[model samples]
Target: MLAANAEEAEKFRKETEAGDYDLLEGEIWWRDRHQMLIDHGYQLRPRLRPGWEPSWNNSNKNPLYCEDAHVGLRLAGGGTIDAVRIMDGKDVGIRPIKRVSSERTIFKNLADAQHLTGQDQHIAHILDTFEDDRDPDLVFVVIPLMIPVWFIASSLKTISGIVDLFKQLLEGLSFIHSKNVAHRGLWSYIMLDAPSMFPRGFHPSDYFQDHSGVHQIKVLPPCKASGPVRYYFADFRHSIDVGQDAKHLIFGYEHPVGADFDAPEWTAIGTYDPFRADVFIIGKIFNEKFISKYENIDFLSSLVEAMTAKKPEARPTAADALKRLQTITSTQSFFTLRHQLVEKDSKEPESLLSENINILLDVAFHGLKIALKMPSRTISLVRRMKRGSKEKETAK
Candidate 1:
């Protein structure tokens, strides 16, 4: 297998030198390593032509090089299709044993979490692993392929759709926390779905052009789906086990920097409860992505606010947030209520007032409470203003 990989790499190198394909240094390295996996009985689909490439430089000569290629893999025994995420082991800055140990820990954490949650559908499962014989340092982790949540959000027709998706995510998070795993990185891209058709790659330069000219660069559109969607959390590279106690603290500056949804605690100088950080991450997603964009579902404002509370201790547990979601879904029925109110208000103002008298009464009740809380002088001033306004109306 080693000799075969070396031969293939030499062949590819010769082909590239002959001007057959303009391959980058990282691309050449990936092809060479991938051949070894194939020799070990792993069947990979044809390289998706025009596949997306990371914008960052990945040349072997560059000190900051890293591989971010995504490829489809046929699971052994033809059970299911999965993705192979190829990582350059050198970039992690850790010994091979420690890195492999971390991978084992993640696998165990997910396995235990699945059992505790009864094989929850919202968590992405790892299928297999492969070690590159050619580059003993490179690791290939296999996981289910999924569509990004942002793409699904584009097709959402109502606030109710968004709520249902979020509910599933909260349930998944609750289960993950129950098993003492902290997904330090929780964002929209982390949420994904298994769709019917595999996505085809396209060159960004084909669709987008600058004044200079079209620069042919491969990229994949965000994944999309047509029917029912099941959201799952993926990318567990940053995941950590906090133990079943839920209060276990993990210290690390490991969270992705400059991520919009990253928890503020991640930037602190000392140890922090990762579970609480997870809550903040989810809350930031809900607050910025869903609630802020859609005004009709403003009822969720308080829930997200509580989840993203500045003080870690003040933030609700994932389980508490899940329970709150259930209550909101059952009681408020905001989508239906919002539509009805809009229709009624548009068709007949008087009928709308009569039908929603309770809403008006509630407003007045709160106003009266505010008035009662004011000082005597403030109350007297309000009364004088009211009388003055009435006199002006009478004069008119």
Candidate 2:
């Protein structure tokens, strides 16, 4: 219950450098006994500062991405991770942390405590969550530094690319859902890592403690595929646990996941089932990928029609959405359809340059063959070109 701020956080860092903070390394490892399991290629890092959490984007010091091993990745807040090392080529790499099931036995007991009960906690679980400071009576998450994918998923391209971006996110939420935990505040920044390091999961200085009641939903638009374009979720401090797979109303999280994403009742209240909620977000991901944004408006329109069906019972599940996506092949190499699409809006005028005409023709004819599912288009295109010598000359 100690209030950690910049001044106290800075003071603690100075003390860590002054030989006061323990790194939790070697021989006698860990203040907690469970930590003894980590060894060999395993390493641990305590709370650190100057990692820099922006006030606007990150907001908190303890984003839950902080950890016990030195994975070197970091996050903004309320993210997920786990222990255990995996074997790599000649060397072992530490497993990126995962959830311990927030609804499971170990963490549920902590939830019963009054101080943390109503603070809107949205995380999955803590390998070991508690507050600490370099100084006595201080509060912070005492673990290694970790980073978040949500904080940097903007640079990737392709629908496949963006869908994959939520790798860690899906893992976190999936783990929680498997255990029947509902992350009420699945907003934009819930995937952030530890802010400072004292409280391990919720560093006091990392974010403003909400004495005034706050409401939120963690990140919506659950991942449809695996890629780099990610969506941030929430303010962990405002998360509420309604019940197992209970459907809840959270504005902005209503993007379609897979088809099964629905509520027994439309309003985001008691019937909030996490599986359905997650599936809905995944369906939203599909919209961005194959249906809504990219090249074919026709395909997208039909997909949305299926996704937006009014009755929750009419919605498709993640499995069903995956089946729908099967219509969009990952490979389109038949190399044979007619002009499947025409691009009048390409920004590159150089694309019309004569120097690349043959190359463009080759690609265009092949693409058409694939789209029309015709093997004869290749020969047909050649015949058309031979018959239109004047037109080819003009393009040249």
* Candidate 1 similarity to native, TM-score: 0.58
In candidate 1, what residue range of length 10 has the lowest lDDT sum? Answer: 88-97
Model 1 over residues 83-196: C-alpha lDDT tens digits?
233442111100111236554566556765686757664666655555546556545555555545664454454455567777888887887776677777646446554333
lDDT of 1: 0.55
Q: Which stretches of candidate 1 lie over 4 Å from their true place?
A: 1-21, 40-99, 115-117, 186-189, 196-228, 244-246, 252-254, 334-396
Please give the lDDT score at residue 156 for candidate 1.
54
lDDT of 2 by residue, 1-396 (tens): 121686755654454446443332321222232343232332222332213222222232322223221222222232322232323212111221223332233234433331254532334323233332222432222222233433323323223333333333454444444344444332243443322221222212222221111211122122211222222332233233445534543454433333232333335443434455554554454455434444423433454455445455566543454445445333322221111222325435564353245335656665564556655777699779887997878899
lDDT of each: 0.55, 0.36
Error of 2 at 272 (Å): 4.6
lDDT of 1 at 331: 80
